[model samples]
Target: MVSVEVLNNHPTGGALCAKGRAAPEIVASPRRLTVPLKRTRPRGAADPGWVEVSWDEALTEIANRLGAIRAESGAEAVAFGVTTPSGTPMVDSFEWVERFIRGFGSPNLIYSVEICGWHKDFAHALTFGRGIGFPDYDNADAIILWGHNPARTWLAQATRIADARRRGAKVVVIDPKPNGSGQQADLWLRIRPGADGALAMGAIRHLIATGSFDADFVDAWTNGSLLVDRATGRFLRADALWPDGAADVFVRLDASGSPVPCDTRYTQQSGGRLRGVLSVRARDGRMISAATAFELLVERAAPYTPARVAELTWLPIADIEAFNALLATRPRLAYHSWTGVGQHTNATAIERTIASLYALTGACDRPGGNRWPVPPPTRALNDYNILPPEQQAKALGIAELPLGPPAKGWITARDFSRAVLEGEPYRVRALVAFGTNFVVSQGHSERNKAALNALEFQVHIDMFMNPTAESADFVLPASTPWERDALKIGFEITQAAVETVQFRPRMVEPVGEVKADYEIAAALALKLGMHELFFGGDIEAGWNYQLAPLGVGVEDLRGHPEGRRFPQAFRDEKYAVTREDGTAAGFATPTRRVEIYS
Candidate 1:
């Protein structure tokens, strides 16, 4: 392409960061890999005879090698790899890549998610079957940016926060190193690194101590009133109270301080005033001491006072108190976290504590707070269940660390190294990586190098020849996003953002024999005899399928390069709304609530 310019909605459509502004350069770079390369020398050699080959030859070789490995070692021997999409053109084909992996029957996907987007994309689901949500910054009254500096990361969000600040919204930024945005905050908490959990707990303590937590929300939408057996640290089940009661039924205390049998049957408010401690009679005629979920949480958070947190975080007591005071205000409390709070060993626990702390505000699905705005309908892309259970069971780390990344078919670099180097769980002989530069992006560069070299066969698909691709037996060229006509579902920050859809028209042609990620995956799938699964390599057909729910088609999107707005709008405070079935719209959690105690 000769040049590129901002497409509609134009300047206000969405602000651009430096990375976005450099798109033209990224597409027309002098270093663009235009041809397929085949390594004809031994692994770890200084100069692998780089030979250019036809796409047919490259695809045939990759298909044969990957197929043979899968046939011999049950598909678990070949691990597929992907990089984070947020920072690259990989976003356009993220779903298609996963589909290809599943269609190929490999349960392991070597993705750099453990320290990038995992906390915001998966860990939060443990508490409520969902992850971090889009913050309603436009309608927000107060914004608590915990470990998230949108100015440096999210330009559109930064613009919204600036507008909120101009309208006098209270802005409190928590980061070790305050940036320009944090500097502009009404209050910036210079917290010590890795102490976000303590600060979150301190905030929770303050909310509860000042009587600022949403009691009605807590009673109705959380497990705060559920009784927990103090001895076993488990929910006191109904089977403990009666011989015939189901184990899934838990005990709850009613308004009259009476023990009541509870299940996930009803998600509405329970007018219970249970707190502190009490003893309940069991089926075995024993008195078991129990505490309400609320009391247990309160007890857990009791020790993390502002003073205590000041020592743990190195922030002044007054700063913690000031944050407490702001959180106690009547305005909606909107908060967010990023990788900063998710890179450490105790990141999960820290994130969970922050999640629990945020639950106390009752700001979810509300105006001026964090929310999951319902988007215009689209067909779901992920269908990992297509892989048989036996294949799924071969995920590298699932057998040992059941709750880790492997539980969801994701592979950490450490596990990938182990599978390739040590073959602890199973050996990974071949690797097909798309846009993933494990050398620069993942931890332990030396270990990753060894693992990459140890692979019997490796195929890399990327625009530039990075260090990670040095070990590849074949290096296939990939097209830039500018050369791909990809449909963007939504901006996903607010309801308005979700209502708008865009079809980013391809601006340029591939430099040489390069192909888009989807094209490569589709061709590879066909070569592997998975023609039906890949829609016969027809990408637009898949795009049309995804657009069916919105009464739109790929041609319609192609006609509107600026964007097209859907008719339906997002609804707010969803849990408070009674449905036609006479039941409230609850959360996606097992308990159908925010699940504070889960």
Candidate 2:
């Protein structure tokens, strides 16, 4: 039984939010579907004509129909749609589903990247070549909540922020409304929406103009000193000027006005002192004037003055100046934003600007700054090579977006509807969705419904029959957490700040003919002759494989329902050290340095 007393263990200090307290009621609701139902009517029919079916019968019919569709229309006609793990834990099945789809020869995996953290991931990867890590609230002297409202969204993080404020950490909240986080902030800037990029650029200009940035870190650890060609707007490679210089090696003007290799060893030995702008001659005897990437960034940010940003964002210039002043003085500062900033059309630029500002302060991967989480030990689950090269080229959003695809051959949720309805690049005849509420969750519900109506076959696996399920040809019942045995290694919101691993056994027997999502996936894989690839229909085998690197097994977790913690300690400035191979272990990027230009 799930007791209300369990709430005490939560990070919110026994303060259970309405949703947390209502979880038991929602799980035991009468509307829960406990059996598989097959629709016998045609597409767009008024009545679904759902008929109860046995698990074996439902799996067989789905496999046969999908096989027939694939044989007739090719594998590109099929697609898979999934939502975030908070609403549905189908994220855990991502690798298995990808394996199944690739083995079946399809390249379409539609997901909620655009509406979630795709912009943040893509922007940070483009700039720092890694996902933006969570802030270290415990050690922070100051925190900026930009476009994020954690109080109502993530109670655990909000609790930590509240505790940080109690310990005298200055809090600044930048949002359009008086949100829950804003209510408790030391300074709240109610700026206009969609103006985050401008504000960030303005702040960067202020920092650069006032010499508030960490110049030492920028010169030593980033590509800020690498010279950029004025003609092509590309980094000036050393090989272009010196015949024997490496092609990947970049050049920076030394004290003698000559180009030198801009490697980390040279920067460390030179004490991070280099010319910001210089003129040089190429092998072709052409005189080229170049400026360092830092100078170029300053030039780009020059136009966004505080007054201009105030006009654009409808925020006070004084407030913007004050915020920048606070950021400049704080020794341990961190800023975070989420979906609100990621939902814009110019989200990539916005997130990149935010990351650039953060990098200027030298607050990344530090004790009291934004720290990268210690990742759980696990094998690479997504087998990228499973999909053939030809099918990968047909992904829907590649030509349009250019970036933002999670994998080389995946489509975003924004493009799924059009790809299915119009079939512009290719037709998508079938959709197998797990826990996605497309009808109400996606924009333009009518259009999403029409796209669903266009599909030749649709399968929905969920705990309840939602609008999406109502339109699906097959609605398979899914097991709840209460009726299943599961393992969770870390808290998603906290980013493993308090590292833990917990195993939850079945609290009660399953209500009816319901099965776990992985079980259904395994059963379908068996029917498709991929049982061996899926570990002979064994979910435990998959878990064990995932846990192999951690030196733990399912057997080890069987008796410990409360879970255990593995010891770990955070290290500062770890990114600048050398690797086991004796090479520099700088930020992961094309240049092996933080790329403000890219």
Candidate 3:
């Protein structure tokens, strides 16, 4: 069908162009005025009377009202919420948004931690002092992927993973589903979900039962050598002995009485002596002799045999042993896990279990192993990192905003919801959400909506009117990525090839009468007389000032969309040790050699 019409600009500022080939019918204001206005509110016992207004009025009310609430009821009375960065293309902007909310000081900075990457972070941190990010694409010999489906969720990551395989990395995928990435893997170990820990443990047993365990590495570089005191329950040490408590499993206070950082052992790149002692005690709390790394590995892994893992996980004994056999080879391995393992009841413990595999194999902080990603400078503005201290405090407050202490102990996101709904400690009153998609994101949608509806103040920001936006008292239209400006620092992984950095430019106008989140923040600060507290001056001017010191101006970024890259940057090189008297240093553990035993 064809329609032809010459028309003036519409009242909404949209051009009144006639429809061509396949198009929707367009009616003018006359049709709008004749129809009864669609009912603004649904029939409900818990509706926050809806009101229509101009953007100025909306912003003014939100800024003033929220500030007033904080002044009168204390910061605890308000909640600042932002959920997962699930569907948005503005992955980089989230870091900025998090800083903005924390700067606001509501203390309820709820994020997509338990839902997204907590398990991975915790597990990797235990072994490598950081979460496992992928190794460089060309360097991997064998890649074992468990509990991650990057294609559907992280397309960019999937591309890199595929690139690695094309470069000769042997890809082994362990997952229940025939996911897009898994289907392309050379080896697919399809076990039931939630049984990964059992599978990994079974591998450990096989490695131990067979002679393929890396005894030299385990003896020199791990806590595996330390023996466990079953009766008194403390790690056996060469010197002092202490009764075991819940937190006393690993490291303890040194001679200076300061607690020896638990993961320091993983960071040691060479042979060293440990200042703190591992200890075991008798029933009467008397000292017993210390054991070596061999003692710890044997004792801790005793309960997780092939048959026991089969029983716990419902996997066959044979499959478990095969996995165990592969692990026994002591090949350099990189491990990663995500929400699938973290969203359960025993998330933290599960993470610790996975972490042990890395430490056992001496793969932490090595080349061709998983390490944190380091972003190149060409991708970023070399500006002085400056954001107000109050703002910093506000962002961290998000984790603490529920008032008093968290009623229920922390575990997973589901547990957090249970604590809120049950009001074990107190009620969850006011909620100000940014980029939160309660419908699809939450594990339980019906219950999440119920909890959201019960809030006193509900605000949302988005480019479109999604279910979450419809439930809000105020809806602030946020700009898409192309219309905004900011800096993004990705995690550092490995020093692979040339250090490359890139930037994307805003390609179009903001969707509607929306604003960049930072500008929105500035406007609110101006309205609330908090300009000095947040941006120091006008937000744009503040941004200009920040840019000037970095040897570039606003014009440079706006004109050059493609970012600069740094050449010949040192990334993965030998870690250095320094001496007190102008000489290279040695390893700093108790046994000068890689301590096979402490």
Candidate 4:
């Protein structure tokens, strides 16, 4: 058992949360699985006889079974499932796992996409071409906690928020239930579930109607001036107007009420120069009235008046007005949200509208507002190109749920059950899950069980034998964080205001013969004749490869258990950098600007 000790130099003053304090008991729990177990009986047997097996034997059997299934039904038949990292560190192997699967020729991988941060990630990418980063609480004068209860969910952020409030920052909380943060909030809006989109639109309408939005930032950094055809609802391309010109160039109306080719260079310095053009006559004898993307957004949000939104969201009209008032009046306002706003069917729309709040107010990428996260320098490990296009075309849910796929082409957990049970697109004959408590973590537990039972071969890697693992054909024990040496770069919960990298040395020997998740994957990769792809089964080599871009190696972290901070400076308006052609390198979107409408 590990003992807790206080250190003066610690970031949190050596403070241990309740969960952290109980780690020893949790790790030493009787329910923890210590050995690899294989089911001896057929699928769906209530009393399936279990037999112990060595790591080598288990890995070989799993590899052979998966290989046979792939040969029979093609590699697309194999699917992978993983839970979020909140419960286990197995997700740290996500990139490597995807690499292995892509090399093995499959495109289906599942995680809690819809119920987690997928909406935030995807919607923000659509609007800003990147994920919204953490709030700059230290400099913020106003905070809006939408559907996020940081007090219970993220204590670090909660503490920072509390301190911000004590220092005169107004706190507004919007949630269905009265939470820890909500109780102390200056204003609390008790919203109805799945109505966040309406509320956000309502707030946006207020901003637009009252002329409280940051017109300068919107006109400059965003696609507010880009003209969209009224008939097609698509941006009018430069080439469409000028047949001999660049097809990718978009059009914007100048101050003199004339069409101008809006290139990347023009976008940088064209703020407030062009008016919001509602329409223009096409050169092809068509009187096409084109509206700016911002104008379209205003029209879209016009219907969500405060009263109507209050009715739809079960919020008070006064509260909605007050919330918008604070946002409009506060100079340094920051908004934050998490899973509660992302679990609904309209989660994408909701997150998009929330992102627009920051853009409309010029809060994004600004000091004391929402700052983009600086990702640690790491090599791209997901060799997604290894999978052929035809195979990738078989990924489930692309037709029905377009925004559910992440950067790595993950199949949403919401659709995993359907793909497995219905086999509408194709049959999924094999599954390799890590850290996923499928029945509990996913929606429709019965469907998940049926899908698991239907699989020709199933493997589950976890520290405990949960219901999902009991249904698997092979269950491999996983090592806990205490039993593994790892590099903790930043806090996933708080987004780490001060960026630092720390080495976590193994505190104790792993229980029984359990191995780290990466080791298991490497062993299986070797059995599948893909050892070279996995750095010849060297875990340290993989770590070094990931850190090479940062000019650090695994050995550099070995002696620095306390971690080291890189001398990086945080700057506001990071997206305002200029490109080589003297145009604005505004954002990474197609229009090279923040997308008000996609």
Candidate 5:
């Protein structure tokens, strides 16, 4: 594989405008001999051991084993898994897998959203009913770098940061360590790790105390003033929740929607250096009150002030305070990128708090500060509805199912290991994985392998032999993104174009026994005697069905790789505040109002 470092400097602007320029011309070279984790499955090596077998043998064994397990233990025993590839073209293949599992009533389709990006999604949904895509990098005045460091982790987004910097946007970085991007920041607030929510709450408090908050925006566009009983719902006084009311401490919203803060908290003493207030909002579009909102406030930031943060983070607080002051004075955009900040227990809360900075400053969904651009392959469900069908199904399951609320699919990677080991409610005896790297994706090294050992069977699909594929009971080889027809889209919201859809051709034949993901899926469906539901026995027919409603067909997309750019953004009707029943639509919160206390 090409190194990410080498791909980092690929041309941009008109240079990158060339189609297929960004992708490598070659998929991979023919591989030499490689070793496996274990030679066979009987020794308890976590995941059935690697054994060389024909594709037919592997497929037959996988189907029989999974079928037997499902027959013995019900659909809950089967789990489907996949990983995030940089340019994954087989999303629909995974979708097909999810559909099959759902069709069989399984609750084990796992994803990385909750583990890495769901906080941003939930936060954006609370604010605008949809998670904003990449930020508008070119149109910012001030940029706040929370726990996120894009320089090393996401080189694609780092280019935008460099461009934003060239245009005189003041860059401020807040992190536990002095990351590469911190060197370029006007100010670096090196506060303690896991203290981001504290810094954000402090900033909000400062904004309110200093009268810099966007009250008009809060009152008009949010649920800032809803009342609720402290004990019954997800709301309450900051003091009641935490004994150290005004001291340096953090507050949080519990599962029950109540505002609570930790005890034994003290403010970092920094000689009155950095402190302030800002308005915050919940999902129902309510703004938090300064009084009740104190739970979400940061009192210690006032004390850590500048000097304390400098001492704690080792980045001079005066410089940090200067950056903070500049951001407060000017328009600011906050970008949340996945890096070190996204791999921790506090990731979701930290991301949400960072997003609150944009909302507090009235920069959310705007031109400069974290603007959310519309997506490609547009569909209608009124404005601000981007919950794809599968996600919607998952959310509905959380709401209506007798099973406990939905597990955090995106955030709970470790739990997968745990569930496989413990099998509390039911055993996750079988795992069907595609392009997933267990060692790379999970942390605790020993536990991951052990969990794999505990599984009754492990089926992996991939183009090349990977750590995961080498450890599987069955390895179903998969095709490359280039060696398959695909509909491609990007999450980047940028300057040049709007909602471009492209098609990629199968550049080469399959290597060895490899097959396109779609083909493998259809074949599996056929083997399972459910061929009609999978693709109606024709790949092109399925593709045509997916494209017909868009007024485009397979022939139109064939032979053209650059694809077409749809002209107009779909203009949907405005969303209503109240339902037709004359009653309010309940917020996801227990009280269903914009939660000020929470």
Candidate 6:
């Protein structure tokens, strides 16, 4: 391998970090797993008694055993495992791995997300009906970094934050410790761990009490004023209150303190009451007591007063107000959060609360805020529909945590280990894992190892023989990102970035008989008679399918390594986009609005 350098004038700032600079060394490292290997001994044996094997010998055995396990104990017996792409070369193969598992009819795919991107990517969907989008740093007037250290984590954002600061944007850092860019922050609060939810509630309370919130946005783009049944804690149905009202509609108290029909698409006039509980006579001859969602939110925040938050977060009232001041005054606010916020006990609550606070600012999907950067319409490859509903229902942990990862075909390490060790939810007899080092990435490492040892069969694919791979019956060599030809649809932070498409050719040859992760999955699928699902075992055909919407294929991308852009103007306030249902399409939540009470 030779030296590495960033492509000149690339959309990603044309820069490289120390890690990126070490790509050549990583590709040529002595520790690299260069060939397929088989364990001659049992999993718990002192030595695996490793022996080299051909791709056919390794993959045919894996496919045959996986099918046998499924035939004997159902598809749920064989689970898939994939490494998080954020810190690994698995980015190119993540969707492909998902496609393989779903096509194979297995509902479980174990990947550690609770400690990583779960909160930012999945938990926020509870309120917003979508994950947090790219922060529009270019036009932001106030930039809030809540437990996010872009300088150390995301160089592209660090560059954007630096440029934004240079352009006179105010900066606020809400973290317990001082990070790199915090040195220049206009306000830095050393918040107590797990108390970010408190700070968010305090901010929302301050905005509400001072009448500084975006009332129009709140009424039109959030379920804040939708009435909730006091007894059932659900949205009060209009039909329950009046004989003429429709069951599909919800009730909201208008400006005159009268109940009005509220639809899922937030198209109501901006006059809903934000506070106070009320009682109304129902058709059932019962007097129902109900409160607006905003009223409940306000009530929830009542205890999180400035003084209370100060005690809980160990920050002075002055500092707390400063934090609220930014959210109140900065109409062009942009914010980001990361692992530090997700590593706490109330991680999901913190994410939801912060999302609610941001909703009050009416900055989501708008200019100078967190805008949903539209991406290249790559036809999605992960078709879970192929996995029948009955099969999907058997996914481990789905019944217990219906809204969590299990619903999305991914399981946590804890539940996965339990399924193997105790078989409470059903035994996971076999695993086809790609690049995940769960033995170290997860908590209770020893228990995880023991569970791995108990598996009837395990196949691991990685560039190096990591701890998790060492426990597997077969360890197949996988090529690094540098040695693979990957098609990039969109970098996704801005309109320009989202419009760009690049196909990167291999930068280095594999050190030995290493195959790309997706290639390995495709080859296995061919053996498993899933040729149609994996594009007839043709990687280029799959890439072509993904590029169809762009009117470009692999051949086109191959000629444009520098990338080609499908230029289009950026659209702001996308939540208010008109829909076919003749309603102002709001957020993607069930109410088509930001959900605070969820």
Best by TM-score: 6
lDDT (10s digit) by residue, model 1, range 1-598 = 5554555463235677776788878888999899999998998678898999999999998999889888898898999899888768898998889989988988899887787767766777666567778887778899988888888987777888999999989999989888766887999999899999999899888888888988888887787888888888888888889878888877788888877887655665467863748988887888999988889889989999878999999999999999888878757877778878877767778888888888888887788888876778888565778777888888988877687788778888888899999988778998999998997788889999999989899999999999998889999999988887888787667666777788889887778888998889999999999887878889998888889988889998888888887856557777667777767676777667777776
lDDT of 3 by residue, 319-368 (tens): 66666655666656655566667666456556666666655665554666
User: What TM-score, to 2 decimals, does candidate 6 have?
Assistant: 0.96
Ranking of predictions according to lDDT: 6, 1, 4, 2, 5, 3
- Better model by lDDT: candidate 1 vs candidate 4: 1
For residues 1-598, write the lDDT of model 2, one tens digit per residue. 4654443453333355555567677667788889999998886788888999999999998898888888998887888876666445564555666677777777777777777777666777788877777788999999989888888777777888899999999999988988699999999999888899998999888888888888777777788878889889888887888778778778876666567876543335234343377778887888888888888898899999888999999999888988889877746987778887887888889988888888889888887788877766666445768778777766777788667673465676557788788886778888998777888876789988899988888999998888998889999998876777776656544444346666667777888888877678789889988877789988888878877888998889887666666656656666777666566667777767778886
Q: What would the per-residue lDDT of candidate 6 be over residues 1-598, giving only the tens digit for each residue?
A: 6777677667775667766878888888999999999999987789999999999999999889998998899989998889887767887888787888888889988886777778888899899988888889999999899888777777777888889999999988888888676776888889998889989999999998888998888887788888998899999888998888888888888888898888765464567776658898888888889899999988888888899999999999999988887777746988899887987657888999999999899888888888877776778777778788998888888988788878888887888889999997889898889988888887789998988888999989998888899889999999989889988777756778888888889877777999999999998888988988888888989989999987889998888888888876668887777778778867777777789886
Question: Candidates' TM-scores?
Answer: 0.95, 0.94, 0.73, 0.94, 0.74, 0.96
TM-score head-to-head 3 vs 4, winner = 4
Best by lDDT: 6
TM-score of 5: 0.74
How far is 450's C-alpha from truth in model 5 (Å)?
Answer: 0.4
- Alpha-carbon shift of residue 321 in model 4 (angstroms): 1.3
- Of the pair 3 and 6, which is ahead by TM-score? 6
lDDT tens readout by residue for model 4, 1-598: 6665544343443345556667788678788888999999997787879899998889988999999988998987899887676535754666666778788888888876667877666777888988867788888989989888887776667877888999999998888878688998999899999898898898888888888888888878888788888888888888777766577888877776577787754545464332365556565877787877887888889999888998899988889888889877847887788888887777888888888877889988887888876766667667678788888777877777655673355887656777788876777888898778888777788888888888878899998888888889999998877888776555442334245667678888888988887788778888999978888988788878877877988788889777766545556787877567766657888888888888
Residue range 285-395, candidate 5, lDDT tens digits: 556553223323333235545555455445555655565566567475656555445556666555555555555576665567665454545322111122234543442
Query: What TM-score quantifies how close candidate 4 is to the native fold?
Result: 0.94
List candidate 6 segments past 4 Å from native. 264-268, 579-581
Segments in model 3 whose C-alpha atoms lie over 4 Å from true places: 1-52, 85-87, 166-168, 226-285, 289-294, 374-424, 491-503, 536-555, 567-598
